[model samples]
Target: MRMVAVIAAAALLTASACGSGKNDTPPPATVEVFTWWAEGGEKAGLDALVARFDADCPGQRFENGAVAGGAGVNAKQELTRRMARHDPPDTFQAHAGAELLDYIDAGQVEDLTAYYESWGLRDVLPAGLIDDLTVRGKIYSVPANIHRANVVWTNPAVLAGAGITTPPKDLPAFIDNLAKLKAAGVEAPLALGRDWTQLMLLEAVLITDLGPDNFAGLFTGRTDWRGAPVTKAVNDFTTLLGYGNLDRDTLDWPQAERLLIDGKAGYQLMGDWAAADLEAKNFPGYGWFTFPGNGNTFQWLADSFTLSTGASNITGTECWLKTVSSATGQQLFNEAKGSIPARVDVPSSGFSPYQQSAMTDWKSATQVPSCAHGSGCSQAWQSAVNAALRSYSTSPDPATLQAALAQAATQFVRP
Candidate 1:
């Protein structure tokens, strides 16, 4: 993919090009960014980063090529079409780990290892996180934030009203808490939304039941999918789902969070990104706890930006990547985005109370990759698991779900 070819192909998809020449006077430099963050705190974070870019690089301009969709549902589809047509943005957002394999395999992304070295990023970012972003000893992207997946958000007023003195620390206690919440007339004790949210809840349960080693093995091919632990986890997930909202399937993550905020629900098991949303709303009486029995663990997901192969403005793209990896850029973005900075050196003063705790926990916790958010498995495997779980949601059968998950592993796992 090259500029000439991309420009030629862009004629067919009119709104796809960075320099479409719709304006009589083109900017001296422009970095067109493609992402799924169209609304909420995520967009605010992007605007902050763009502001940094504008201030730092006087001549350069930021072009938002954002498409609206939760979890990049529509953006990914359009990005695929643009990439296939050899018309790619200067930079595009993607999950950091194995989710990037598809772009790398297709030769649609550029290696960013040299940039990491030149910018001294190896010293600023955690070594383990940097290793996760690298493939075959080379890097391809700059991680903007680290999101913790296995978090339980609580409305303090709701919990205190139900006479729950403390957050659950184990599976048994968690179930008991749910029962207590239900007994208190809380209609949705555990608020869940859509298929991805369901998967997030299921993975948190799997981590609690299987322990960190076994859970990590599920992704690394060291754990047997048909084993009793997996079976028990599936059963546990089904039991957990019983307390979810009746209209979960129709709502997205934010809507489900509303149940918790509005005092209609007691708990929500979601990523730290929810904290940013809550903070933006000046949400009071909110508290957080690690998901049951997973206190010493962190289920990690990172959002990163990659340089596309056929960028029209390499200089502008490089400038964007530099800003993304800079300490100032990371701190400002993560403070608004509700995630911890990828740069470990950033001071904790920039984060909110919840985010400050997460930053402290990141150092000591045993990190596990997140499948629901694209760190633990390939996109194909994730799709398969999602299908199986969505089916399980309707059927509510544990054995069937376990068997289906085992089959998906067999098909997607490599030798």
Candidate 2:
């Protein structure tokens, strides 16, 4: 009987051990990444990023929650709904500067100050970028890539066809080049998309007209919106629009780029993301340069991911962020995305010639926040500007546009 009792006790202990083992099994890994990168090179870059995450992070299933719209319009709208319902994704894409402040203000994002330190990012990223990303002594997102917004992409073959032997060096040269291209039978001398693309072009014009400091001052209340500098920018933008495609109001940036790629247009002034798209197409003889008269300045925008406050898979989200923050991941993703890695320490050998040039410029160029891309101004301010520009495009009047923009700025520009 004592022997029987000993066997029974051993069986009971085995059962308890089995139960504990089952209870200790790790929960299933899942990560949902949200972004507005739904097509073209942006999607390709995102796929490369997810593939890296899949390879490095075993057993984690990644969910791509991509929404399509220009400048993250649809994605932000959907994200607003999700955040309101308290059902946030593991991570969401956001522009890295004042744009991120909105999420921080709503307490919808987690503080990543500790992660930045632990990951040694503080040493790798530019000090100015770090300061821009930080607010109230804490950072809230991880920037993946830096894009230059003041770039002009030209098809060398088209430029040559248009009797242009050399790219333009300054604003007057650019205008003359457009005239040459038009005389050479080009319908669209300057390819432009809808509202935001016009706004992007306007920002570059503003920089050339106002210089980097005053261009920045527009947001800080240091520069007068109704002053001569802004007035000149508005006039230049109106003149530039005269060279734009007839269907400028109908096409998105991608469609506008198609005009340049097909040799129907001589130049496309857009962010470096367009370069990535061109690279993906393997279109040879394409060249890039900074906006006219703004060679020394970098109108910058960055794509960053923020940790959501209600993330159901914090571990998986952190794993994804760590992977993106790694050098290998940055190189792979940036190669596909047509942008430079945020980490200045990353090797530039993997980048294309255009990207290599951009990286070199990024190191020494005077950095200016891209107002159209959500870095230089608040969302409200940006929206107001966008509205004013849309109306300005329809009217194509400099004086009226200046007045409207100044009124909009007064309403929203806090500083």
Candidate 3:
């Protein structure tokens, strides 16, 4: 009887252990990260964020879904497919402006207003940022950082070779400097890349020089796309592109970057991300300045990530969402990215000389808005603008192009 009782007690204990809530399996966490930042400095920025997620949020894992191209052609295609099938990436990057409303309208995006309130993100971030990220009183995205879009990047040697000791402070002087460089046997005045990236630089110049209000007018259809301001911006951009040695439609962004990196080109109009390439090459004494706006106001741009409707809870995805938003995560990520964190309070001491100056300029601004592509306009609106502008840049047919722009702004996008 004693032996039987002991055996019975052991069986009961074994059963309790097997059925105990503590001993039951704990579910794993995950989130898929979809982005187009697979190469150059973008990868380094991504790695820093990944490291943080792993350290702080155990058991969560990321499926690194990356694709190439400045337009994020592949990434956007994949996202569209997934959203169509009800299987979207946990989170994805989009220009912070009105570019994201399409997803929200499709009901494929989650309203992050609650998350913002719960985490105090609204109070922590700046008012301009809150306005940019929020649509119709609900937040759907969080910007990772602010990438100044109209920076002219060059090596000191290129400037010195042109017999110019200093960059020009105004548009005419800048053009004269480029001409001097070209006359000095410089192969290219600017290292302009092809396709969508090429168009982005042109758009940045038009927006900045046209003034923030007028720039917004172009996107919101308050004003038509012509007149002295628009014409001058386009003409100057075309003249600048004409000086490039490489074909404007074929040069890849990386190859174009090499022109400035190797001191072969006088300069390149690019986003702050260009600094990432400069830093990686250990390229010395690089210079950065806003594209001389021809005595007009400087309008810039921004980009961010928005979680898809069902993406917030995926293990790896959720970890990254938290990791990318936190103060520590943003600083570490943006430092490698050659950008300043979007958060207002992150210390700027670690930034490079140019970056520090840009940060100062950005913080003091009362009305920094988006460029055409990065503007809260849909891709359809941008595409029509892109087509019309591309045609006008090469063909000089302003009448036809201006009419198209007016139509594009007034019509509804099929997308």
Clashes of 3: 8
lDDT of candidate 2 over 76-180, digit per residue (tens): 999999999999999999998888767888999999999998999999988878877777889998998999999999988888987787868999999999998
Report how far off residue 363 is in candidate 2 (Å): 0.9
Model 1 TM-score?
0.91
Q: lDDT for every model?
A: 0.87, 0.88, 0.72
**Model 1, residue pairs in steric clash:** none
Cand. 2 TM to true fold: 0.92
- Using TM-score, give the best candidate's number: 2
Tell me each candidate's TM-score.
0.91, 0.92, 0.88
Runs with alpha carbons beyond 4 Å of true place in candidate 2:
1-27, 55-59
Number of the top-ranking candidate, with lDDT as the measure: 2
Q: Which regions of candidate 1 fall more than 4 Å away from where they truly are?
A: 1-26
lDDT of 1 by residue, 82-201 (tens): 998999999999888878878888999999999998999999877778767778888988899899999999988888888997888799899999988999999899999998888899
Ranking by lDDT: 2, 1, 3
**lDDT accuracy of residue 165 in candidate 3:** 85
lDDT of 3 by residue, 277-311 (tens): 77788885688777776233334555577778776
